[model samples]
Target: MEERLIMDLVPGLEGIPAAESAISYIDGDEGILEYRGIPIETLAVKSNFIEVAYLLIFGELPDRDEYERFKSDVTYHTRLKLKILRMMEWLPENGHPMHYLQAVTSAMGMYYPARDTLDEEVRYWSAVRLIAKLPTIVAASHRLKHGDEPIKPRNDLSFAANFYYMLFEREPLPLVERILDTMLTLHADHTMNASTFSSRVVGSTLADPYTIVSSAIGTLSGPLHGGANEEVVRMLAEIGTKENVRPYIEARLERKEKIMGIGHRVYKTRDPRGEVLKGFIEELIAHKDIDSGVFELSKEVELVVAERLTGKNLHPNVDFYSGIVFNGMGIPTDLFTPIFAMGRVAGWLAHWMEQLKTNRIYRPTQKYIGKRKEPYIPMEERKRATAR
Candidate 1:
């Protein structure tokens, strides 16, 4: 006799291997993250965002000539076409930045067709254009929503510095530019994150890179994945004073509620990205002459949460300190996730490239739990049954 086989369903596919990827790695228990075999800590401190982006997408660090060429391509492509800019003007001003990002990104497919996902040239240019234009789109979204004309990207500025300039029409201070670049490197990729997973899934169908990235952007817009940084800032604001930190955390704990930014699904220990941002927060506060109230409050919350929750491996994640850093830089809270999308797009494109190599449309099996079969009644029969 032959035996039937069954598989247990895993909720959210937790701990299941979706694909064999060499793009990024995470060891939750050890609190390690790497992009293409380089430790995130090293990249965050030693490399700029563009370099890190090239490394992620190409699976190796670029030499001087390669870096210059890639950088030049990205820099040259940063400006949106006039029609795309006109389209942005018509979007509802009150919509979230992520929506603007998603719409514009998806529309890019119409303007720059990449239907041949297998063509190397098509993939290369698509990656360049998406990486280059996302910051421009994000900056434009923020400005247009506020009834302000969007600023243009400056080719002379470094990638991170240009983003800052486009957003505010002024170059970032030296330290701010460095921190923003590091933050981008830190967020460039993470293994099997929701957005990366979405990218791979969509890319499996050989979809154009723009559509793949736009799908990933939509996934990242969900609060569970990308909104924690904004929530962390809000939590700090509500705490309002160092004295309130412990009580507020305890109250939330007692009610079995989440402490925003205090935990991560993948990191059972301190998130390595959070540690890097934490150090930067300290450095920025001490040297930059900015208001440090949020930093101090964040420290208190960390201390309190550490004392109470670290036993369960619920320590602060990347969002914890990233919010403090962005808040200190005077970034509006709503732009946090959109900025996250900007960095994670590198990962999305990398995964999209990887997914095409072993393309298989994702078709996971489902366990059916609903009624198997039911006869459809004619309209008169249904009416008689209702009457009865």
Candidate 2:
């Protein structure tokens, strides 16, 4: 038996190359990010989010013809099934949209059953339906909860713009639309994070794609995972100002409490996604002229926390700045995680497709500690005998 828990195995798992990928490298020490051998900074600055999605799914940047086809396919499938829209309406308004999304995603598998043949055309349609409808479902849920009528998707608009327009019932400002697009591109994929791993594990069993994605969403709903940004926003709100940040962080550090969004399981130094989001947050803040005092306070907290926990090697992750950007975009606090789902579903689908290509059942080994041999005893008889 192993004498101690091997925590370092977190990064280096045998036979699981999913965790480590040269395809998209995150250099945490230097705060650099790259996707498919291209620097993330360049993509964020130059490419639109839909283009990035195409890159992740197809493994190369699409040329004009391929890009047009991809966009057309996505746009054609953006409209939800009428039955699914009715189901969305039946969902409780106050309930978390992620829960609704999970249920809806799982339910989608039932609506679109996989054929025995499993032809390439079938798989292609499945991919299109998932990628296009996900944002529509999420945005519609947002509007539905707020007692507003869900806006129909505009085929002419880009995916990000359509999502924003649907949620707000008006055209988004050009800069805001671009920022949202960049954010979606940045989040389109990462190598097998917890939720992506969950999706892949399910897909390995040859389960329906919707079921796999639903499982992924359930995993991401946890606070330690996708929901951290919501908590980060609340934490910043509680801190209220730059002056309160140091004292608040000091108090939390004294208690050994985790400052939400300040740590990650994979990245040792800094999250590359965090760097991109920090820039977006700054842009949004300046564009909106919202004096939230969050950016200054967050910077102070990051500096002080790094100084305090030297050996822990913790830093602000992607979730740190994402909430601020969402808040700046006029998004409510509760809807943050659901918005994360909008971008993450693409990655989930990509992993699902990859898993299906090399079909295998995922069964992990567990370290069990129990009696090697045990005799069953009659509970009533043993208790009576003991009393006597």
Which structure among the candidates has the greatest lDDT? Answer: 1
Residue 146 displacement in candidate 2 (angstroms):
2.8
- Model 1 root-mean-square deviation: 2.5
- lDDT per residue for candidate 2 within 104-161, as digits (tens), equals 8888887888643146676677777888888888888888888888889999898888
* Global fold similarity of model 1 (TM-score): 0.95
- Candidate 2, clashing residue pairs? none
Q: Report lDDT per candidate.
A: 0.91, 0.77
- The TM-score of candidate 2 is 0.86
Off by over 4 Å in 2: 1-23, 115-118, 288-293, 296-314, 382-388
Evaluate residue 173 in candidate 1 and report its C-alpha lDDT on the 0 to 100 scale.
Answer: 86
Global Cα RMSD, each model: 2.5, 4.3
